[model samples]
Target: MNGPDILASLRANLAQQVQHYISPIPAPLDVSPWLAMALLQKAIRRGHHPFALQAAATLLQLSPDKLWRRAVSIAFEDIGIADLEIVSLVTASLAGKAFRAKIGGEWLVASYLVERMCLAPKCRSADDLLMLSERHPAYEHLRLGLTYGTIPELLALVRSNAPLPKRALALWYAVGSDRCPSPQLRTRKGAPQTVFDDLCEAGHPHTLVEVAREGFRRSGQVLCPFVVLLASQKSEQPAFIEDDDFPPETMCGSLPSWALDVYSREGQQALRRFLGRNCDTARWVRSHVPPVQRIKFLGDILFAVEGGLLRNHYRWPLADELRRSWAIECQGPFCPDAGEIMSMLRIDIQLLNEERQHV
Candidate 1:
């Protein structure tokens, strides 16, 4: 099937009158769990509530647990610091089937929370800071050295007037290096509750700490701490504003570019074809990357330069710095040629994205 057009358009259009985000994209619903999940988060970030709702509903049908998991992550990951009340709402919604059943029923509660998150202002600095802390060359010394600090020492450092990145390291060690959400750091012993408790004891708000604690309990994302820490900064007041870069986007048959994420079936095929090209990005990866890992490595680079973020980003001083660090530091990690490869992919990927139109 190329894509569902006529019937889906009618069903989706009819859905628009009763509820706003209930209307899905006028495309096929035979989407994978990965694609549905991706569309959910990206749609929320882009403020495309219709697709967000559709994706959430799809997950509710195919994988109820993933629907809850992704919603919780998006809450802490996307809407961090912009609206704590919304974060707490999303966190509470994840309690369990019993809680959701008591609140209203599963769909009513899930759909309402999903729509609320879609409309909420977003801040991704926490996630950006995670990437920077993990892979940025500037943080290598901090990562290695802090890996050796005692829990008390690290906790003390976390509350001191240190730079944000150092605080990130101290916080990481204090919590335990074992919570490797990306599978990067490993083998350190510490309890996550201790980190949250110390943050509260060190003068952070109890409510915010509770939000992060619950989020961390549910998602196991290191980003949870980063969210509270980034918000608790007393160094300066950073101005927040909206920014839409309007990156190249178009429809492939009926599905929007937002649905054409790296994990989608069609997207995987496109990347495979792009890799056969003689472009600098493809050439460097072919020669530098191991034969078994080429696709994974190249896909990471593509995700970095391409639609890995909102076409519209919530911008602020510290968040923008973290974003820049992500652009420079996170390209597939462990590859010396990632800088040159990312530069090439930024240009070459457009040609590939254009080809997606006719495919």
Candidate 2:
């Protein structure tokens, strides 16, 4: 089926599922839409259905647009190859507030998706590869060349037997950097439609391709198509779905500890207070990182440890490599002492969390 037909069929087939889906989850009365988004993704990643549903409800009330956008992104970014059907369901949910109202109402549809995603198998390889393609020093020359390659040439390269990440770079360039802008990459106009059609021609699965197309159309992220490309070659391989280690969890006032991550205003203040203390974590950051980059540096480590903690770890050749790259290159080089620093932070973070709750 073509893109529209595929979505249409999904909408028809999943209508009953959404209509009957029910959750008693209540929106946290005080969560800011920003924290709600942060909580939603992490909750989904951790397979915490209650928190995911609550955050989804809160975000739906506060910012339905961002809620839907976040849903589509996690579908590609976290749940990519593990469950393409769920990805497609989330993609179909992007049909706007009205369609949702008809099929199951906004909250029902949103809650249904959050619950399913929490239970679905997880794979973050697509977003991991996208990050590597852009940031890893090895791709510096490849990035420059692909950024300027002609649409036809880039399209051909996408189908070539090049390395996976390199081919992803070519596919992104073909999709047009202008459409999927990255401050890190030189931007050019891309033929996103042609790129999607070409993937179909290249024998990639239709559901994945269509989800990628609609996902990119909605999110404007290159990770969408990368999910299709990454899954195309690995779907048949021996795959493992194991329970990942749980990230340390603590409560900060009314919200989960993660909601106070460096991005949140509260999280920043807590980190500031945490850093101000006469502690080894503070001393290490002070000596190793510049004064200006300390909070961000620490935040990156915090993310490595706590954020994006996938509860359902999907293992395949490419997915495993991406996980290793994430450990070694993605976060390893930037913060070599991440483990040591995290141990230090754990000791005093509670002190800051307690203080923030009072504030």
Candidate 3:
């Protein structure tokens, strides 16, 4: 199969309302539960959600309780701070009857599991620490606490063993303090809420916008007003403006840009005009709609692109533009300038040429 041709075809069909790409559900293998579960873990770790989902479903068919337990374990061990929401989401799925019920219930569970796992950022620090705690003499208490006690219980044990390993303790605090919504486990109090909660509390509607703003603050970059307004909506508990009102003039400012050199004079003017139109639309949306309804219209584009699922579903021109903008801004505050970009391009070309010669 030609790679470029495949990409072109995929992009061409991106605008279609229906899904053209359907991955085959995995068939069950006559393997041990441990081995099959291991394979499922590998697929999920590699972000092969389609394969992982199918494999998990096959495993679940063999033993639902076991597979559900394994999924919960993987959530805490493998996926840590990279995605704080996965544990709760997986816990919800485990308790959910949707996985066992007929009439598309099984598929619904599989879809939810796979999409969340695939979209979440992967990290294994918690996994590594858990492994070390099993053998390390100093971590014996920590290991026992993890095995038999709640997160806070484990933290209390580790806190007493402070001089053992500060880094490991920090990792435990970071991952363990997250709220676990599973009904089966002992709930810990004063745990850090979900990222969405934090963002919502701080008055930012969009996750990427909050991330981008933090990136700019760390790197001394300017944030565009349009992106800011697009990130924030009419706040529910507002102190300054009315809950329904939007301040258009206050929202137009500079956005972080790496392509600004290329977008000089007329380019900047054209971009501003484009932003202006968007700003007007945003203002209209805020004024006409309730705060609850306005968030989806303003923030869904960034979230969709961040998860890489929106591109697969919608090919609206505006969505495409937002994807491109996200691609640029999501690189954090300091993007590579033209010269650095050209250098990387040259390196890539050189490697491609070398591969071709060898072939």
Candidate 4:
């Protein structure tokens, strides 16, 4: 065939190939090696340029593996930062599909040309450069000398400089707001159980503050133990003096003003009415107050006392006298039906004693 006829035939074949292979979403650019090679071969047959034909041939000669690697690179470099989801989806899809092995030599070259033409070039700025450096310090030296002018240049730089894991991390951070500082920190293996021990031991304000700051740094979330410890430290109230000899009503009245705020109005009224009606009639009180109700009330009172004692280990001076009267009236051998109430009160006493040991 004559040179002009061969050139015309090559152009017609390339146009057919383009229609068959390339998807028509983004406008196809001249960056495609397959397209460039076809055009270059046609021009060379027409005696146009030897250097251009050699360049296209060299690009066409790239192995499938190298071309697929370039495609993966373009996925991240071109689609990353601006629309990082595309990078993730493309990378995952490529990995899952095993595109390099599936496409084979010539087809792989054609696929690269199509992909390169279809996707937009991504650009990275000084901010992205700094962030990349922070994310992967290993690449700091390589990134130092390069100055990127376009999206394609930035993508090329990333492909050359960043490792697969670093590329994945950068893509993850770019795609989602829930980026973790390090994978180890996010995983269970990186967290230490001793941090919880420290929080539990954080009895004072200073220690709790330190635990909170350290916990936040170690894990993105706050540790519950430190929060509890801090709350306990901050809510500590002043000690109240208890009068053992005073009536239950009088003792309740003598409670600190701040202590009154702890209970709801209804609870305060119920407690006050119970104390007022039962202060002198111990026998009647035991009969009216059911064993279960007495036990529940005692449990609540014991919890309050333990919390109060932790804040300030003050003796309720009235506690001994009240206990003496309660023991006599509720546990006395002469009192009939005292057995059940006494049994419930004894259980409360045991719980109270246990709480004291912990304090």
Candidate 5:
């Protein structure tokens, strides 16, 4: 297809894909970055770099600040309460003139859609909040609320706030922004009075102002005033905020606790049965597998478990053991020069785990 026709086709495809994946408000075309990128990509793919640059400029027609502001708006509005990283990255890239590739901008936009659809963590951040506030006053209130409040309080404010812009602001602030009171504080004891928790509990709008001020004292952050403003504007209870650190097992949707409990019981039984059935084979495999291979296999198995993925779980002990063993194993003359074989075994284990999860 010619440039214009290719652009139109790509735009239509992107709109359909985005809507299919995200069901964004006010149709996908209203936020033109995706389309602009698509047009740019088409130009570049056809070896038309000069035309691509002109097309991109004509399509955005935005000052750097305006483009960034619009990008943030799209990031929060369409991507919504999902990942903030893509939004943050895109905004930063645009602001800093870092994404100069012909297809780089479009790739970034497409990546956001893909990540959102896949339910991965969207790395949006507090920087997006600051940018939105500077560009749009309506968004400033929402950003203020989120910056100051805890996750729960932010959720409550968003649900009851009026005016689509106000509600959008709340989503922008609460979900899109990624500021938190440090991962260390997450484990602290006692029902601490977080801006989030306070918003969740406050009975009156006036209470939010005082709470917001107090939140600033406690957190020493600048987002408190906006949190107080959102709380003051709304007067209804909101849904419970999804606890951030709740085990991923709870959020996977496909694996219910009961099913996992049953799976755990059955998995144990299956392991025992296989062991009994293949005791001879298991021993033979173990004996035949080199020491390095065995150690590597054990490490691979540990990583396969969901709990093992946590930093505290695997980093220190497993890493230390691997390093110590690697020194000894590499020095030995009879270390079963099966490097390719061991590599294949690790790959096989990973593939097996992936297949099991799919089943």
Candidate 6:
């Protein structure tokens, strides 16, 4: 038959083959559900495949439905853009009533759940981004047209021989911010590449472009790179510690005047919406979302941002500690105190946003 049908047949055959091994399921734990789930997450993060499976099995003994839902949440929040397709795989596996009801459908699903969790690539960038986005003081200023109104003037100045780094951030901001009315990004290999990618390829750092693509793929949201650039400009300390961490700001010395002309033509409403989300809606979306699908959007964003900050800021100092604790390369960058970095980035962006308002 077709590919999916064949795959289904294979899964069915494999499930049957393992049927004898599925009995004597683990006893339901007397532990708190949150605690049990946390323990399972810890195992998964540590790449302890056996322990992760055992935890999933334990949770399944209590409630298959809960296990299934939690698995999806982890796929989004933990795995995230590091492997965006994992969420789709999780959904396809747990999509229907029949699939959920399948070993006559119980424990096989647990096997599927654990296998998926263990195999998925983990990244916490989205989580960190969400957390930072929440408390960023600039959110209010940006929403009120304080930051939105400056685009034309800023674009004009960048085109008029302002530093290359400034030009690059300006061009990237227009394209990456979703404020562009009719964005026509270039494509490479049929996937959309950012307008600033050419500048990136020419030796300028493209962290913003990479961030925008990864964040969008994972959460369907466009990150405002301009916010980051503005934040960096205001901070006396460099946005990145290492010069090579991202492309040098001066890589593109002068942007074409026409590059950002398109944004000037868009109506105020679209810009307002984007600004509102940055300033207002985003603040509560994370904490207020229902548990089942919260990680899908809000959670993914927070984890990814958190992961990014930890990687950029604390990765070196904690390397030895991380090596001891985590077997995977991905684990080296995690920091429990990532909120501090987020606050720093947010405050810089906020200060710049505030400055723009007063000027």
Q: Who wins the TM-score comparison? A: 2
> Which pairs in model 4 have colliding backbones?
122-151, 123-151, 242-318, 243-318, 244-317, 244-318
Winner of 1 and 2 under TM-score: 2
The alpha-carbon deviation from the true structure for residue 288 of candidate 2, after best TM-score superposition, in angstroms, is 2.5
For all candidates in order, the CA lDDT equals 0.72, 0.80, 0.37, 0.31, 0.34, 0.39
Write the residue-wise lDDT of candidate 6 on 1-359 in tens digits: 43345335544654454455453355444544544565466455545456566667767776666676666556554554444344444544454557546644666656655665566555543333333322233232322232242445434543445533334334434343443221222211111243334424433234433433333343333222322232233333322222112111111111111111112222122222223344433344333444344323322332222212211121222222322222211211233233343343233333222322221
Candidate 5 local lDDT, 286-311, one digit each (tens): 55656434433333222222211211
lDDT of 2 by residue, 1-359 (tens): 77789889888766867766665756654778888888899889989988888888888788889899999999989998889889989998888888888986888888888999999999989888887787676787998877768888998888889988888889988888888887668978988999999889888888778878888988898889898888877756889888776555677666777767788877788777777778787888888887788888778766656676688777788788776565456543446435577667666566655645654
| Error in Å for residue 266 of model 4 | 89
Clashes of 4: 6
Work out how many backbone clashes candidate 5 has. 14
Provide the lowest-lDDT 10-residue window in model 2.
330-339
Predicted structure 1, TM vs. truth? 0.83
Arranged by TM-score, best first: 2, 1, 6, 3, 4, 5
lDDT score, candidate 6, position 95: 41
Error of 1 at 167 (Å): 1.6
TM-score of candidate 6 on Cα atoms, chains taken together? 0.37
Q: In model 6, which range of ten residues has the least summed lDDT?
A: 251-260
TM-score of each: 0.83, 0.92, 0.35, 0.21, 0.20, 0.37
Against the hidden true structure, what lDDT does model 1 obtain? Answer: 0.72
The local lDDT score (0 to 100) that residue 150 gets in candidate 4 is 34
TM-score, cand. 5 vs. native: 0.20
When superposed on Cα atoms, how far off is each prediction in RMSD? 8.8, 2.3, 22.4, 34.0, 21.4, 18.8
- For model 2, the local distance difference test gives 0.80
